[model samples]
Target: MIKEANTTFPIHPLIKSRWSPRVFADTPVSDEAIYTLFEAARWAASSMNEQPWRFIYAKRESDAYKIILKHLAEFNQQWVKNAPVIILTAYKEKFNSGKENFHALHDLGLAMGNLSLQAQSMGLAVHHMAGLDWKKLQEIFNVQEGFHITTAVAVGYYGGDPSVLPEDLEESERAPRKRLPLNTLACEGKWIEQ
Candidate 1:
């Protein structure tokens, strides 16, 4: 089930092997593994050492898990139910100096990147979703001001019956992975519209 990226240039094996899956096995991710993933995120580079990222996670069997599922958009709820773990991501909107931290979300993304790669290394699958009711989550969690909810993530071991998904999603699950060419993404010292 390894959907390794077909890259033009060689890349790290973990990066190549990582792909988000809508289906996840029923196996429970170990607490140790979860801690390890966060440990990796904890070391990611942040602006001015203001590691603004915050996470609220729940195991599938927990009541909190149900609450999170309820807040997700209908489409995400369809597939995320099978995940062993659900995580809510957020970032502080302001620095300790009371100034806006424009890079808060960017730093949060770096942290999630670290977590995702760590999950891949551990033989787990991670899928990030932006389709959720963030305002509800904020209210539910009583997240104080200056912190903004960003996204939700599903984590678990891979291998589930794609056939169980709706026809369209099943097709998407089985589709070949594709990416834009590097030339279109990066150029020398100038912006080029492709």
Candidate 2:
């Protein structure tokens, strides 16, 4: 289940080991470990130190857990059942100055990146998904207008059989990870085609 990245150049082992998995063991994650992951996110760099990122999480046994799960798209709901922890990431829409925080989503992504790496370091798996009912999330979590639900995360230990996943996901779970080459992704004052 360890799908180490096949990086062309040397990269940190923790980065290489991080991936989104659909299959998760049903074992419960420790509360302390969850706090550690969020703690790492709490320190991520943000625009003007706005730190707009916020998280709402629920352990499998909590009532809020089902409320969070109900917001997921059916495809995610299927495999997400195996995860012991569910979390939703949200970001503030504007700064206290009444100015729009254009970088809110970007900063939230940075926080999630930090959290994901921290989870990987702790031998835990994190699967982030954009497939969910935003409206339902707002209603269930009582999210205010200024706060937007960004992504849902499933977290747990890695120990589920690929066969248990849906056909397409099963294949995807076993397939090699792919990413565009740096030349195609970065450029010196000009964009380049892959």
Candidate 3:
């Protein structure tokens, strides 16, 4: 099942092929390729096109990459260090005018989604990691104020044998995916429960 997503997911070739991998092979992700993915994300829809999303990325061996690597918790670093690149997704609330700009993060999500899909289309693996260190991320990159770091993703080719992954992870990888019964989450006319 490790490779099953390539055939599923609502996204076209872009998203259907992406998945989170804890291990990435030792290889270089070219700068131009990353730019192409970001370009696709740059075109995603935004609130009034405020374009709240911002991405800070680092290639595997650069000093900037080291900064990103430091922001990850010990657990994530163990597996992610080998990734060809790590991209941090952020959203700026200063662009909005209200007490609540909930849509800022939503917009960032859309951008990241677009980025991930684009990466997949290029035959790359992108893994979203939420167990990020906020303080380290904010401090290390010197990100401008008001932009909250939402997620960090490890991108590259997957490495390590599935057999070597911890038991639970291995089993989870092998299991068929289960989704909610559509009726439970979606409603027909009147917008009421069935």
> lDDT: which candidate is best?
1
* Model 1 stretches astray by more than 4 angstroms: none
**Model 2 weakest 10-residue run by lDDT:** 19-28
Q: Give the per-residue lDDT digits (tens) of candidate 2, residues 31-128.
A: 99999999999999999999999999999999888988887999889888878999999999899898999999999999999999999888899999
lDDT of the structure predicted as candidate 1: 0.92
Error of 1 at 93 (Å): 0.4
Q: Backbone clash tally for model 1?
A: 0
TM-score of each: 0.97, 0.95, 0.83
CA lDDT, every prediction? 0.92, 0.90, 0.76
User: How many clashes show up per model?
Assistant: 0, 0, 0
RMSD of model 1, in Å? 0.9
Query: How does model 2 fare in lDDT?
Result: 0.90
Better of 2 and 3 by lDDT: 2
